[model samples]
Target chain A: MNTIEVKELRRIYKTNIGVIRRKVKEIVAVDGITFDVNRGELFGLLGPNGAGKTTMIKMLTTLLIPTGGTAKILGYDVVDQANEIRSRIGFIFGGERGLYWRLSGIDNLRYFASLYHVDPEVTMKRIPQLLELVGLSDRGEEKVEGYSRGMKQRLHIARTLLHDPEILFLDEPTMGLDPVGGREIRQVIRDLQSEKKTILLTTHYMFEADALCERVAVIDQGRIVALDTPEALKQVVSDLSVIEIEVFGVPEEILNQIRNLPFVDTVSVEDLDQKQALHVHSAKGSEAIPPLLSALEGVRVGKVTVREPTLEDAYVRLVGGKV
Target chain B: MKPGMMKAYVHVIKLTFIFTLKQSMTDAFILFGIFVQPLLIAIMALFILGDQGDGLVIFIVVGSGLTGLWDSVLFQSGNSITRERWTGTLEALVGMPTPLAVIVFGKNLAFVTQSLSSMIVAYAFASIIFGYPLSIEAPTLFIISVVMTVLSLVCLGLVLATLFVLNPDVQRWQNGLEFPVFILAGFLFPIAILPQWTTPLSYILAPYWAAVALHMSSGGKPDILEISVPWAMMALLGVLYLFLAFWLFRKMLFKARVDATLSGQ
Candidate 1:
């Protein structure tokens, strides 16, 4: 059975412009989107910034009323049975702004636990357990203002789990964290998935979605462009190979020259601090590398490697390289 | 409400009140509004109107205390929802099973609890430091008047909170409202002495009636009719404001969800 089902959900925002004579302009933030998540599945919504990922999550969590269409969570209609739906689900948006900075981490959890209507006895036992689960046991007594960004994110996770919610909505849970912090949160997500909790996670990190999501929905321009497992999505670009070249100051002309190559499908450059990683997608795989290197004769190239297409490569192919 | 839901509401109220109290105590600006602002007003009143009489001293003390209460209501109660929005907790609070009214009520209760300290500070300043003869001739009446005043102001704050949540630009009007209420509500002086035209405005304001009840109970006069009229008026207005506040709160929440403005657009 589906834990969550959305049918043609839409959200349009009207923005006003001009000072003296104002004009109303409508922007379709979440245009006619439809998808479903099975019970106990870790579903992912992958999109670029302002791609309506947060808007969709807000609608599912019953925070935002859909402009059109309908959604039901755990069999409760989001529009009519919001209270019933809210009682059974928990959500956490990214960043440290949601918590009361003056209150201690434990105090914050205790307060949210009551809001979620957890029994006092259950709260007493669960608060510490959740704190330990989030690896915030030692820092639970400290004020939230003093916590590091990652610790606050962990506390947010713990706060959401206070009521033992059956479904969780996490929007970019590791958006701004360091690698270790991101890994820690990913591990917690993995553990929750193991416990058979239904989760809807929206993220910009392709690898994170690929690693955790049982089914992924690629949303772009307020619509779902693709929906499938990571492996299946990656299959869209299976005929192509990604050739990555680490170089110091490769000129734009060189990139253009590589892009002009007959066998190259796409050439994208990523700034790697003092160096740059040039990703060359080719239909000819390793066979295109000889001409690609010869075309960049004078460039200071570091590492050269070729690999199978990743979810990111698939994303670029589907979204037309916007991400 | 069912028993389980009622229990949940009570738990939310308790938790919200405690956490809001903690948050207010740590907020430097809230601390200043609750304690420092009233203290300064009381001192200013003593210095400017010191030589008037003992009756005037009591009036100033009570007026300063009410000023603090009004200030707390204006800032804390009016801005509570907006503050939650800025903290990114408004969505979480709105998404909860518990109604938003219960959470806001709990928050305002905490502010009212904090507002009580203003009265204590004012009384202490007037009787102890300034050596003024302050007495409550009708102790029961005085207590009743104080409770009614706080409740009435909280109701007004509730309305403001809902209004501000729906139309955030109106928040600037809060600063505009502070002194007008001080003047119109007769917090520092009698509305009778102001003007013939201002009486109608003062008559409708709950705080004006609250001041009348407080003044009459504090032995400014022994007219039972004067005390009872304002007392009854304040109670009626409290009910009216509460009714209006709840209605507006529900409307605001519906509009917020529809417009996706719960987090303050």
Candidate 2:
């Protein structure tokens, strides 16, 4: 059975104001929707702003109740079995409201440790492992208030994993991190997934999603528009393939000649000082590169490379618009 | 309780108690002197009002103490939540799986314990130095304190906590509320001595009746039977507030389904 199963869930909030200045109105936040995540699978919910990804995660996590329909986590109902579900899963918010700055890192962990009811003996051992995993062993005794934003985020993941929960709900886990930190966090996620824990990760960064999630659900306008493996989703938008070509000091004639290649769908050039940033798209990366190169052969080419379709390009195509 | 359930609730209760105690110092200190300001006025009443001044100390104690409890729950719970929300910490806590009820209990319990302890200290100080014909009958103080805690402040905390969930802007409400609760709740002087216009406003709420009952029990006025009517109203309102708090929490949870922080799209 799927670790999480949701069926036609809905959440409607009332915003009342009218003749009485309090007449009720409904704001349907999560319209009817359905999906299931398998055990040990790192599922992803991809969405643009306000596409109901967070709403769905909150509902499944038992922080919110659905107005219509139902969801179950580890075979426990999110509504009727809320307490049970809360125990079975852990959630990490990419929110500023992450930790108790007043307390040290291990103190924060200990507090949550007590809440999880891990035996004191077991928790003692687990705390060190968690601190080690997050590379915070040295800082474990320091108050989180002094920690930088990235350091605090790592602590948040530790808290989410504290209960040794089988399923993890990570909402924009690598948000606001620098490239190195993001990579570090991505590696941590891979490690968690390797332990066979199910993670339903949400992120707007396509590369972040593509790198971590094996299967992804693309949500837009409060509904799931597309759900597939990252490669599968890319394949959906891979039809109009876009490739970037780098060239130096190419004249307009050669640029025009490259654009006129048989299979080269569209070509654009940019003059960056003495260099040109060339953009090309075709049905296949290999099919378009040779002809484009041949056209620019005599143009004092310094460096030439064929680019593959990035998930960013796929995302733009997925939304059918620009970022 | 199961081991896990026991752990969740124990953490809730223990954490709540500490939080309330720490928060109470800042809140009650501002008001403790306010709670006693009337007692000093009552000593002045010995010269101003003569024989009638005999029970004035109890009057101020019971009245201000009653209103103090009101102030503690309303101001602390509402204002703290609002302050934290603006500071951007409320969303972080609320995003967790732990119920909102847990957050309310932990924070308010801390404030309440601090208020109770500080109020006791303020009363002891006044009884020693100012010496306003004090009497601390154990059974009476015990019964009234219990009533004040359960039927008035804690119940009110439920409502205030719910308000925190939605609107954290409580300064206006707290400012407008304190004196009215003092005047109407009959905390300082008798609601009866207040002008007829003010009596209607003061006795209209549960805190007013509760203050009066506490005043009577604390040796300020008539017997317990005379205070029974307001005591009954206080108890009823307490239950009602608790029910309303639960309902409010349910709606907040439903409304806050999308953890605002996770707008990944």
Candidate 3:
């Protein structure tokens, strides 16, 4: 059964410009997107900045009303049955700012516990258990201002669980964390999954989605371009092989020439200090490499390697190389 | 509602109050508003109107305290919701099962209660440091008036918080709103001294009645019937402010959701 259902959700922001003569510009942030998250499923939304990933999460979480279409969390309408939905769901927007810096970790939890209307007796028992779960049992007395970003994030997770919500909406929960911190959060998410909790996470990190999510949706320009298992989504580029050619001074026109080849799919350049690396994708595999080299002519070349496409390559193709 | 839900709401209010009071304690701006500014105003009032009579000391103390109360309401209570937005917690609060107005009401309760300290501080500074003997003519009535003042001011604060969230231009004039309330509320003098036209303006403000009731009980003992007028006005206006706030809160939340500017600067 679907725990969260969204159908053609849309959000448009009207911005007024200028002082005297004003002009209204309507920016469609989320444009009629439809998706569903099943019970106990780990769903991920992958997109670049301003691709409506956060907007979609906000709509499902009832933080923002949809401009069109409809969404239901645990079978309650997001617009009309918000209070019923809010009670059963918890969400965390990625950042350090959501916590009260002046309060201790325990105090913060205690305070939010009251906001969620947990029995004070239950809070007395649950606070410690949550602290232990987040590995902050020893540091619960410290003010959030002194806690590291990772600690604050863990506390945020603890905050969300105070109500023991059935559905969790995390918007880039690991956005700014270090690799270790991010891994710890991913572990927390994994633990939640083990407990059979439903989670919808949005992130710009492709591999993180591949590692954590059961199914991932790749959104671009306010719409979902592809939705499938990470491995299945990678099949968009599975037929093509990626050739990385390290060249010292290859011009843009030469890269364009490789794009014009019969088998070449897309060509993108990555700056590598003194040298620029050209990533050329083609369906002909290694057979297209010789022509790619011939197009390079007198451009000083470095090591060239060819490999199968990963999710990142698939993401690149779906978003049309916007990454 | 059921008794269980009512108890839960009370518990939520209790927790929110304690936490908000603790948080405000660490803020230097809140400290100045509820403490330093009031004491400074009290000292000026003492020196300026000092020598008039012994009764005037108590008058100055109550008057200066009202300034602190109004300042707290204007700045601290007014920005309660905006402060949550700035800290990025507005979304979390809005998404909670409990209504946003309930949480804000708890916050305003803390602000107004803590601001009451301005009166105590001013009273202490007068009776202890300045060696002026100050005592309320009717302590019971004064205490009751103080309670009414807090409730009414909290309701008024609710309106301000939601109004400021709904209209950013009104918040831009927040600094300008301060002394006008002080003048019109007659925190330092009688509103009767002002033009007759401004009396209706003063009558509409809860702070004005708060001043009337506070001054009468503290400085001179008035009969129950005489003092009940300000109390009734405060009660009536408190209900009006609450109704206005209820409407404003709905409009503000809807607007914020539509605009998706809950956490925006």
Candidate 4:
């Protein structure tokens, strides 16, 4: 059974601009997007900045009302039955801002537990268990302001699980964390899925989705461009091969020359320390390499390799408008 | 509401009250509003109105005490929700199954309760330091009036919190609101001294009734029949402001979601 059913959901913001002559500007942040998440499934929403990932999450979580269309969580309408839905769902936005910095981590949980109306006896037992689950049992006594970013994030996870809602909406839960912190959160998420909780996660990190999501949706400009399992989504770029070249300084002219090559599908530049890594996608595979080097003959070059396209390559193809 | 649900609501309110009170106690601004500001005003009022007599000295004490209460409700209770928005916890509170108004009510309760210290602080300053014997003329009526003042002020706080969140432009008038209400509510003097036109305006304010009720029982020397007028006005105004707040809370939440402005940052 589907835990979440979203049909053509939309959210538009109208704002007035200017001092004397005010002009109303309508921004369509989420435009008629539809998708579903089945029970016990881990769903991922992949998109670049301003792609409506957060907006859609806000709509489903009842933080923002949809301007048009409809969405249901566990068979309750998001608009009309918000209270019924709020009781059944738990959500955490990315970053350290949501939790009370002045309160201790355990106090934050106690406060939320009260808000969720968990029985006082149950809260007494559950708060410590959740603290242990998030590996913050010892530090739960400290004020959240004193916590590291990772520790505060762990506290947020514990808070979300305070009432143990059936559905969890985590909007980029691992955002702005070190690799260790991100991995720890991912481990907690994996554990949650084992407990049969339906999870909807949105993140810009492609591999994080590929590694954790049961199904992934690539959204761009308020619309879902592709929705499938990670393996199937990668098939979008399966025909294309990636040629990576590390160079000291490939001037704009040389990069443009690479862009103009006949078989080159797309070329993106990544800045490394004192070097620029050129990612070239082409169906010509290794046959497109020699000509590419000739274009960069004057530049000091380092390592060069040809590899199979991954899920991130598929995302770049989908969101970068190459597909 | 079922008995179980009512119990749960009480539980939530109690927790929210304790949480807000603890958090507010750490704030220096709140401390100043509740303690220092009122004491300072009491000293200044005693200096000016000192030689009048013991009855007027009690007047200064009650008047200056009300100033702190008003400041606390005006600034602290007023910013309860806005402060949550600043800390990014407003969205979390709004999303919960518990009503946002319930939590805000608890917070205002904490604020108004803590601010009662202003009255005590001023009372102590007058009786102990200034060496004036101060006593309530009608102790039972005075206690009842104090209860009414707290309830009415908390309800007024509900209105102010919602109004400030709804139109930030009104909040921009926050600093400007303090002294005008002080004058109109007769916190320091009688509203009768103002123009007759402002009397009707003062009549609508909950603080004005609170002042009249507190002043009468403490030192104004009103009979039971006479003091009942301000008590009735406070009760009526409390109900009116609560209904207004109930309506404003719904409107503010709807607008916050529509405008997607819950995250002030």
Candidate 5:
């Protein structure tokens, strides 16, 4: 059974610009998007910034009414049966801002449990259990303001589960965290998936989507450009291999030369603070490496490796640009 | 509503109240609004109007106490929704199955509980430090009046809370609302002495009736039969304000959701 069904969902924001002489402009944040997630499936919405990922999540969560089309969660219409849907679903937008900073972790959970109308008997038993699940049982008495980013994110996960909702919407759950923090949250999400909970997760991190999502939807400019399982999506670039070259001070001219290679499908340069990782997708893989090295003859190349296609390569090919 | 749902609602309100109270107690600014400001006002009143009469001292004490309550209603109750927005919790609260108004109601109840300290601190400062004779001629009537007054004020706060959610600029009017109630509500003096044109406005205000009931009971000069009018007026207005509050709450909720204004999104 499909736990969520969205049909041509659209959102247009009318914002006023200019302080002294105002003018109204309509920005299409989510334009005619459609998708569905089956029960117990971990679905992912992948997009770059301003691609309406968060806006779409907000509409499904009933925090923002769509400008057109319709959505249903667990057989309830998002527009007309919002209250019913809310009771059966939980959502967490990435940030520590949602939890009361002054309250202890346990107090925050118990307080939200009452809001969700969990039975007192259940709450008393579940609060401690959730704390343990999130690895915060030892620090549940500490104020949330004192928690690390990872701990707060875990507490957020615990808070959303208080009602035991059937569907969870997580928008960039690991947006700004250390690798360890991000991995811990991913583990918790994996645990939830094992328990047969349906999740709709949005992230720009292609690897994270590839790792956790059963199916991934690549969205751009407020529309779904592609939707398929990780392996299938990666097949878009199956004929190509990714050549990652670590280089310092490789000028833009050299990068453009790599892009112009006859065998090169796409080339993207990611800044690594002090250096840049040059990703060159070519149908020639090992054969193209030598020509690529000569192309960077004047620049300092650190390490080079050729690998099979990844979701990032697939995303770049599908979106026609770097994500 | 089903019994089960009603029980859940009450449970939410109770927990929200306790948490709000606990949260406010630790904030030094809220503490000033609840206790320190009222205490200072009582001291100022004692010095400004030295020993004019026991009735006058009690008048200033009650006025100062009510000022604290008014401050809570103005700041805490009024800002409850906006604070949620600033903290990024408004979206979470709105997405809950429970009505946002109920949670806000619970929050105001917590502020009301803390505001109760204003009355106690005022009384203590007046009686202990100033040695002002503090006595209620009709103790039962005084207790009843105090309860009705707080209830009425809380209902008024509810109305304002809904308005704040709809028009946050209304919050700028907070300082604008305080002194008018202090003066026109007759917290410092009887409304009769005000310009006759202001009587109609005062008559409809719950605080005016509350003040009359408190003053009459404290003076011990009037029987229950005589003071019943103000008591009755306060209760009637409390019901009316509560009805208005819920109505406005529904309207604001619909507007906020439709306009995508909840959490100022």
Candidate 6:
């Protein structure tokens, strides 16, 4: 069964400005968007600022009522059955925003545990396990205000899972972490996915989407532009193999001559050192590379590299370079 | 409701209480010195008003008691909403499985706790330190006190939590509930002390009547049965505010847009 189902979601905001408050602005933060998150699958929403990623997540989480359409989590309607939905979900937000600064990290976790109504006995068992899982077992007694950003976020990871929720809403869990810290959080997420938790992760990093999400949705202006596996999106632009070539002393006119070759659809000459590169674009580009290499036989083919198109490249071309 | 919903209120109460205590402790030292201000004011009212000494003392006790409770409860309930809005804790709560009612009820736990504490202090001071010459009919005073605190705090939390959600900066203005309540709530003097022209504003808020009911129960010449109308009025306002607050906060939650601002942790 789908763990989360969002259909034709929309949201609008009315703002009044000016000293007289006469100025009115209506902001459509989330436009009609639809998608489903299957059980135990990692889902990703990718977007720039103001692209309505948070708005969409809020609607699914039932934090905001949809202006249009409907949604469900674990088969509970987001609007009509929000209380049931809340019981089944665990949520973590990035940075210093989620945990209480004054409370000890353990206390914060315990407080939320009470909110979740874990039996006191189960809570005792779970607290230490979560503490160890987040690797804060020893420091659990310390207050959150004194902890570093990464440590605080680790505590948040523990807090979200304390209720043993079936679904997780992780909003930018590794947002400002260093490379090592980000790597650690990624490992934790990998572990959670292994445990068969349905995860909805919103991230700006293409690699994070690629590494964590089984399938990704690129949302812009409150709508989903594309949804596919990272490899599949990369395939959107993989019809043409991208090859970088370096050469020595090839003239622009000669590169133009190479461009006129029967198999070549487009070409440009550029110098890599003293060598010139015949930058070539062709339909059966892989098949045409041998001919292009033959045509530039006199030119030293100093180095050639071919690469599979990346999701970011697909993001730029198909998802629009703006978003 | 599931057992989880029942316990959710307990958790909210714990958080609400702890936060209020933290806030009170941070301000307690300073208020500790001013604590004697009520004692002195009670004495002054007795001395100046002479024949009205008992009446005036009841006003003082009721006013200080209710205002003290109001001061803390308003911030407890309203400020929790505001602080959650500002710190994004409310956003986190929004994402949780906790219902809006549980959130509000739990948040009000702080104020309810504070109201109980402040009432104790106010009554203890009135009965012991000031010795302001009053005899409260215990049962009547107790019943009325409970009604006033329960109804007012619930209403204020419900109606004003939304204001905080709408304006995160309004947290600073929460004193708006406290200061006016202290001066005009008619806790030290009878509402009749105010000119007839001012009576409308004072009565629109229920705590004033609560104070009067306490004064009647403890110090006034009125019979116990005569104070029934006053106690009933206060209770009615409290219930109305409670229902209104509950409905308002629910609507606010539904209308909120709590979106994540970043991509990763």
lDDT (Cα, tens digit) per residue for candidate 4, span B82-150: 999999999899989999999988999999989888999999989999899889898899999999999
- Residue B216 lDDT, candidate 4, scale 0-100: 90
Sort all candidates by DockQ, best to worst. Answer: 3, 1, 4, 5, 6, 2
Q: Which RMSD values do the candidates have, in order?
A: 2.0, 6.6, 2.0, 1.8, 2.0, 7.6
TM-score of 5: 0.95
Write the residue-wise lDDT of candidate 1 on A104-181 in tens digits: 999999888888888989999999899999999999999999999999999999988998999999999998999999
Instruction: Kindly state the fnat score of candidate 5.
Output: 0.77
Model 6 lDDT at residue B142: 55
Better of 1 and 4 by lDDT: 4
Which digits, one per residue and each the tens of the lDDT, describe model 2 over residues B184-219? 776666667777887766644766766656655666
Could you list the iRMS of every candidate? 0.9, 4.9, 0.8, 0.8, 1.1, 4.1
What lDDT tens digits, residue by residue, belong to model 2 across residues A1-323?
Answer: 78999898887766658765667777776788888999999998887766777777878877666789989998999877777777678888775455667677887787676556556678889999998998899999988879977788889889888779989999888888888878888888999999999999988888888989888887766777778888887776566666666676778787677667777655656567867777666777766666766787776555556556766556655554323
TM-score per model over all chains: 0.95, 0.74, 0.95, 0.96, 0.95, 0.76
Ten-residue stretch with the least lDDT total in model 4 chain A: A314-323
- Give the per-residue lDDT of model 6 (tens digit) for B1-265: 6655566566566665575455455555325423444445545654566455555556566555665555555665666666665665766766665555566666566555545555556567766775655556566565665666465656656666666665557767766656666656676655566678878888767767766666666554566577767777777777777777667765566555433321212
lDDT of 5 by residue, A1-323 (tens): 47999999999988899999999989999999999999999999999899999999989998888999989998889988998999899999987779999999999999999999999899999999998888898999999999998898999999999999999999999989899999989999999999999999999999999999999999999999999999999989999999999999899888788788898888888889999998888998899999999999999999999899889999988777665
RMSD of 5: 2.0
Candidate DockQ values, in order, are: 0.83, 0.24, 0.84, 0.83, 0.76, 0.28
List, residue by residue over B156-181, the lDDT tens digit for candidate 5: 88888888777768777878987888
Q: TM-score ranking from best to worst?
A: 4, 3, 5, 1, 6, 2
Which should have the higher DockQ, number 3 or number 6?
3
Q: List the residue pairs that clash in candidate 5.
A: none
Best by TM-score: 4
**Cα lDDT, model 1, residue B148:** 83
Residue A290, model 3: lDDT of 90
Worst 10 residues of 2 chain A by lDDT: A314-323
Candidate 2 structure, TM-score to reference? 0.74
